[model samples]
Target: MILFQLSHAAEPIQVDDGYTVSKRFEKYRKLDTTISLPKLSFTEGQLVEFDLRYAQVGQRELHLDLFHAVPNKPSKGLIIFIHGGGWRAGNKSHFYPLANLLAQQGYNVALPEYRLSIAALYPAAVDDIEQATQWLLNHSSELGISTSPLIIGGGSSGGHLATLIGFKNNKQAHLLTDKPIPLYNAVINLDGLLDVTSELALKFENRKGNDSALAKWLGGRYETIPDLWHQVSPVNYINEDAPELLIISSGQARFTAGKDKTKRLFNENGRTITIIEHENIIHTFWLFEPYLTNLAADIAEFLMDVSKIEQE
Candidate 1:
C-alpha cells in the first residue's frame, strides 16, 4: 500500500477484516467493493448541511440531504448521491459518510431519499429520482452550486436508479413533473443493478434465494413481467447523447451479472464510458475500509476530470 503523509492524508477509512462472506450475502460481494488501487490525491475538508424539501408526493413531503464541503477553493460540480437498499430498505442517511468525503473534494453532494418498494413500486422509485434531479436542477442557485453538469451517483440498487433516471429515454417511463427532462453532465454508477430480465433475475435468485429483490421492486417475477424488466433497465436506454458514464464494479455479484452486458451496450452506443474493477471485496467497499480514503480521492478526481471534459 502506498503511504500518504498527513498533508495528503484522507480520513481513515472503515476497515473490516472479519467481513465474512456468507452464502446468503455472497451475491452482495459482486458489487464494487473498492479494493486498494493506485493511491489517490487527498484534500482536507468540512461539510455544511442543508436540509430542504426537494419534492412532494401525495401527503408525503420529500426532502433532500445536501452536504457541501467547506471549499478550500471553488466548487467543481454538484453530485446527487443515492443510497442503496435493494429498493426495499435503505435511507438517504446511509450516504452521509460518503457525502462528506465528496464535499471535501469540492463537489456539493445531494443525498435524496426516494420511495422504497415497501411504499411504492417500480417506476415510483424512478419517478422520485426524476423529481429529485429536477429539484436539484431547479434549485441549484438557492443551493449555492453550479448548475451545469449535475452528476448523478449511487451504490447497489441506488446505482441502478441513478442510471435509469440519468440515461433512460424519458418517454418510456413516468415522470414526476411536466418540466423539461433533467439532463446530467455525467453519471457515476457503483455496482448498480443493470439487468432485470429473467436470465439475470433467475441467476440472482438461484444464487441468493427465491425471493429475488428484482421481483419485489418490480412487483412480479421477471418471468411474469418481462416487459417491465426491459423498460426499467438502464442498459436499454443508451444513446449517443447519453451522459459520459463511469461504472465501478467488483468481480462478484452485480458485476458478474451486468459487466459484459453493460460494456457492450455503452460501447455500441458510442458513449464515453470508464469501467474499473476491484478484487476480493463485497459491494461498496469504500463504505468500509482503508478503501474509503482513496476512494473518496479517486472519485473527487473523476468528478473533476469528467466535469472538465463535458464542459469543453
Candidate 2:
C-alpha cells in the first residue's frame, strides 16, 4: 500500500474540514449495506507520481497526483478527475482509489487539488482546475503520455467544474493565463449539478438558508447574483461543439438540475448525452466498492467509445 500526502513547500492555507472517504463511507454504509469502501492501494503494474506541482497562486501551490500503467504503452488517454467537497472541503486524495483503478485499465488518471471555497472562491477553483489540466498537457511528453481524446470528470462539485470546463472549451478568457484552455473529447459527470440556478438546485442548495455550501462558494445567494449563477452553469454553455457527455446519477434528482434542458439543447444540435441512473444509492456512490468498480468500467467503456469515434 502506497500512501501519498499533499506536499507543500510553504505552510499550506488552513481550510475548513473537507470530505474524506472514510467519513463518507461511514455515512453511506448505513444506507446501503451492499456498499464497501475500496482499498486505497496502488494497483499492480501501475506507476504513481505524487505531488507534482502544477500551479501556484500566491503562497498556495496547487498539485496533482498521477496514476498510470507501468509499461504505459497503448495508453487509452488522459483522464483528469477532480474531487468534490461542495467546493469548500475535499482533497485530491478522495479520488486516489478511482485513479488507481483507472490506471490499471490502461488509462492515465490525474487527481488535482484546486483552491477550495474557503481558500479562494468561484472562478479560483475553476481556474486552478483549468491550470492543472493545462499543466498536464504541457508536460504530457515528459510524462510519457499522449493527451489526445482528453477526458474530464468528477463527482458532485468536481463534476460540475468538469462539465463547465468541458463545455466552455476555453472559449472564454481564462482567469490565470493567456494560454488557451485545453479541450476535452469526453466528459464524465458523476452526479454533479448541471445548473446551479435551476429551481431544484436553488431549493436543495439553499435549504440551509444563506449558509449553504453553494452560496459560500459562489459568494452570495442566487437572488443576489443571479447572473453569476447562470454564468457558472454548465447548461448555459452547451453547443454543438461541446464534448461527448456521460452522466452517472445516484438516484438523486435534485443534483441533476438542468439535465433535461441540457439534453434538449444537445438534441437540438443533433447531439445526444448518455445518462446512467443508479436507483437507491447515495450521492457519493463512486467512492464505494461495487459502485466504484462499476463506475471505472463504465468510464473506461465510454472513453474508449469516444476515442474510437474521435479517431474516425
Candidate 3:
C-alpha cells in the first residue's frame, strides 16, 4: 500500500524497498496453489498455470515466471513481457494480470526479472533479459513451443529494454542466444521511453528528476556516457529489419517527450508500425485492471493476427 502511494505521486521519488520479491504477497506465487487465468468477459476458457524459477541459479540470476494456460498441450505461441519501474524499481509478479490475460489466448507468456538500479544498473538489466530470452528459446521445446515469432513488450523502462532487444542483436546479444534468441515477429512498446537522450535534451522540461532516474539506473551522467546511452536506445538502431511494432502511449504531458522518440521510430519504419494513442491515460495505465480488458483485447488481436501471418 505504501509503495502504491509512492507510485502515484505527481513526480518521481527515490523509494525505499518496502516490498521486494520475498516480501510481496505469497498468493502471487505458483507453488502449493493454483492460479486460474480467468477468461475475459468476451473470451472463454482462458485460464493459465503459473510456473516460476530463476533463469540462472545464483545471486543476481534472472527470475522468470512462465504463464501456461494450457496443460499437456503445446502453446501456439509465446509472449515475453518486461515490467517497468523507471529502471530502478518494479517486479515480474506485478505483471501476472497481464500475463494471465495473454495466456488465456492460448499463448504462453514469460515474465522475467532483470537486475534493477537499486541493485545494479543499465546493461546489467539488459544482460539479464538476454539470458532470460535465451533460456526461453533453449527450452522452447520443453515449454511446448515451436516457432520464431516471439513477441516482446513492456511498460515504461521495460518497454525500453524490450525495444532494445528487438532493434539490435549485439555483443550482449549472446545473452538471449544459447542458439540465437530468434528474431522477434513483433515488438510492443507500452508507453516506453525509446530515447533517453531526447528526454534529457527536452527544453524546460517540468519533470525535474528525469535525468536522475537515468543516472541512477544507468550509473552515470549522459555526458560522461554518451556511447552507453546510444547503445541502449532502441530508437538509435531503427532499421528496415526491425520487428513489427505496436506502440501504446498516453497523451499526457509527462510522456510527450518520450513519445516523440517513439514517433521517430515509427516514421523510419512506417510499414510495420502500429501506434495506439490513449486519451487521458497516464504512463503505465495497463498495470491496473480498469484498462486491462481493452489492453488485453488489443494485444490478443495483434498477437493472433501476427501468429496467423507466421503460419501462412
CA-lDDT, candidates in order: 0.68, 0.82, 0.66
Compose the digit string of candidate 1's lDDT tens values, residues 1-312: 122232322433121222222321354434534333223234555546555777767656567887774668677778888877677776676676677777766678888877777667788888887787777777778767775657888987888888878777332334435557766778888888676553654676546443567777788776677798788778777776677778777556644355577678778977678777787466655465465665677677676677333431
- What residue runs in model 1 are displaced by over 4 Å at the alpha carbon? 1-47, 169-178, 206-210, 307-312
Candidate of highest lDDT: 2
Candidate 2 residues lying further than 4 Å off, grouped into runs, are: 1-12, 40-44, 70-73, 170-178, 307-312
Q: Which candidate, 1 or 3, would have the higher TM-score against the true structure?
A: 1
Candidate 3 per-residue lDDT, tens place, 111-178, comes to 88777777566677877887777787777787655545578889877888888887775323444545
Measured on C-alpha atoms, candidate 1 has an lDDT of 0.68
lDDT of 2 by residue, 77-98 (tens): 8889988988888888888888
TM-score of every model? 0.79, 0.92, 0.75
Between 2 and 3, whose TM-score is larger? 2
Q: Rank the candidate models, highest lDDT first.
A: 2, 1, 3
Q: Candidate 1, 235: how far from true, in Å?
A: 0.7
